[model samples]
Target: MSADQKHFSPPARLLHWLMAPLVVAMLFIGVGMVATLSSWHQTLLAIHKPLGIAILGLVSVRFIVRLTHRTPPLPNDMPRWQQHIAHLSHWVFYALLFAMPLVGWSMLSAGGFPIHLFGPVNLPPIVPQDVQLYALLRSAHTVLALLLFATFLAHLGAALFHGLIRRDGVFSSMAKGRD
Candidate 1:
């Protein structure tokens, strides 16, 4: 693709869309996990913890790939405010992507729980078990997840508004492999 033509590198595009659904699932599960009781709740916790770590792994790989690949710039005529918002939102997404998993892992580690990544291999706990700390991190994890969900909605709304109303290629840029 020409430098002037807005487009996503194939890997970036794939990773972007792939993570969208996973992150949404993680957020839903995070919320749902809290409301349940008994074996069902435990099952969701098992899935939520590991799945979140998986998303973190994917986000790390995506970030590295994005760094290695250059994305075309926003349309030259795009307004400064819109451009600023887009940039800020993207960074916030990354921040949450990095923070949520780390907090969860830290919480587990501090709580003296192993991180089981859907495999027999067990991850050693990071922090020594402490009830007070565990409670604090647990709350932090949930709150951050909620914040991330809201930011994600705002991001999606902006993309749709830009793509459908502004008729800009902002949304298309992430999935141009089909377009």
Candidate 2:
């Protein structure tokens, strides 16, 4: 591909930037939810539920964007193993992006909690209510969330390695739409 053509599509870049902050916010919100039982806990819950759903919807669209568009290739001088890792990391990101919300939704459903987005709108339960199932799913959600946070940090570090250290176009392909 031509150097310029190596960049991601405009829509893909936009979605990437947009979701970055939202995902970070969701992680912090989750931490807040667990770290306190104060009155603010409820406020956090109200925000978290809807935000998770929003991420779910956006990720569905993002997945389609990813599949339909060609991503910028890694630097030719980069190691084959690194390229494999990079490709694996992206699929992990997609899997976690889809999993986090679905697991949250299923956990809540098992706990018999409402999936309120706003106003009177509520999502129907995906799994039947069972205390044991709720406990298992809740544990799974926490573990997956921790994994997500670690993955996000790894991605940021990789981006900086490409942008600052390697002087590679990989970061710019997403950050500025050119390498």
Candidate 3:
């Protein structure tokens, strides 16, 4: 591939850098939400719900951008297994991006709770209310959140490996738009 093709498109990089911190904050916020019984719980819930919806929307757009554009290729010298792992990890990130909010929304729906985004703009429930369903979805959402956090750490480690250790362009492909 040409040098240009070896770098991620501008939009892709923008979405990536934009989402990274938001996702990290969301993870920490999630932990706080579950850890506290104080008044802060409601505060965190308010932030968590809206932020999750935002992530879902952004990820949907990001997925479209990804599909429409060609991504930078993995290094030729990289092991085949590593390449496969890299690809799988990306798909997993996409899956978690899409899954986390939907599950949260569905969990709320199952519990018959309102997803208040702002005044008069609440999200309508997608599932009928059921205590059993609520329990199941709540558990699923927690598990998915944990998985997303793990994947995020692995991705960050890989990027550091390529950038700091290997001195490869893989990290720069996403970190910088050009050579």
Candidate 4:
């Protein structure tokens, strides 16, 4: 493969694809958790907590993989501003990926809620419970979730721009390896 066309390592690609749907689902679940007053609220909460934790774990590994590996470079013909935006957006994504789950977890901790990962797999609280603290963390979590969704949309738009308009390999680099 050409250097610019080099695909992400399999593991990185796997993590990227895996996290995409998961993050989307978590966003929807968060909305559902807040919107519903029925028994389904608890049901959504059950899914949201564990999923956030899972995202946390996967993002940790993804961060490490990102640090240790080399990603394919953007097309040389792309504008410098676009390249800068691409790099900045990537870091923003990484930050959001790490921050969203943490804020959610801490929000629960501050509210004295158990972060039950699964059947009997409860994570310990990172902060002591306080109503005031819970309010702040909960607000932060909601704002960050909104920010994450915006970033996701921007990333998707860029991917489509590259894949469709530019016909560049940028999208395909993560989509698949050179054929």
Index of the highest-TM-score prediction: 3
Task: Judge candidate 4 at residue 33 and give its lDDT.
Answer: 85
What are the clash counts of all predictions, listed in order? Answer: 2, 0, 0, 0
Report every candidate's CA lDDT.
0.84, 0.92, 0.95, 0.91
Best by lDDT: 3
- For residue 36, what is the lDDT in candidate 4? 85
TM-score of 2: 0.97
Residues 47-147 of candidate 3 have per-residue lDDT tens digits of 99999999999999999999999998898999999999999999999999999999999999999999999778899999999999999999999999999
Single out the weakest 10-residue window by summed lDDT for candidate 3: 1-10
How far off is model 3, as Cα RMSD? 0.7
Estimate TM-scores for all models.
Answer: 0.91, 0.97, 0.98, 0.96
lDDT of 2 by residue, 1-179 (tens): 88657798988988899899999999999999999999999999999999998899889999999999888888899999999999999999999999999999999999999889899999999999999999999999999999999999999999999999998788888888553
Residue-wise C-alpha lDDT for candidate 4, range 1-179, written one tens digit per residue = 46533888888999999999999999899889889899999999999988998999999999999998889888899999999999999999999999998888899999999889888799999999999999999999989999999999999999999999998888999998656
Candidate 2 error regions (>4 Å): none
Residue-level error in angstroms, candidate 3, position 106: 0.3
**What C-alpha RMSD separates each model from the true structure?**
1.9, 1.1, 0.7, 1.3
32-72, model 1: which lDDT tens digit per residue? 87877767887888888878878989999998987888776
Select the stronger candidate by TM-score from 3 and 4: 3
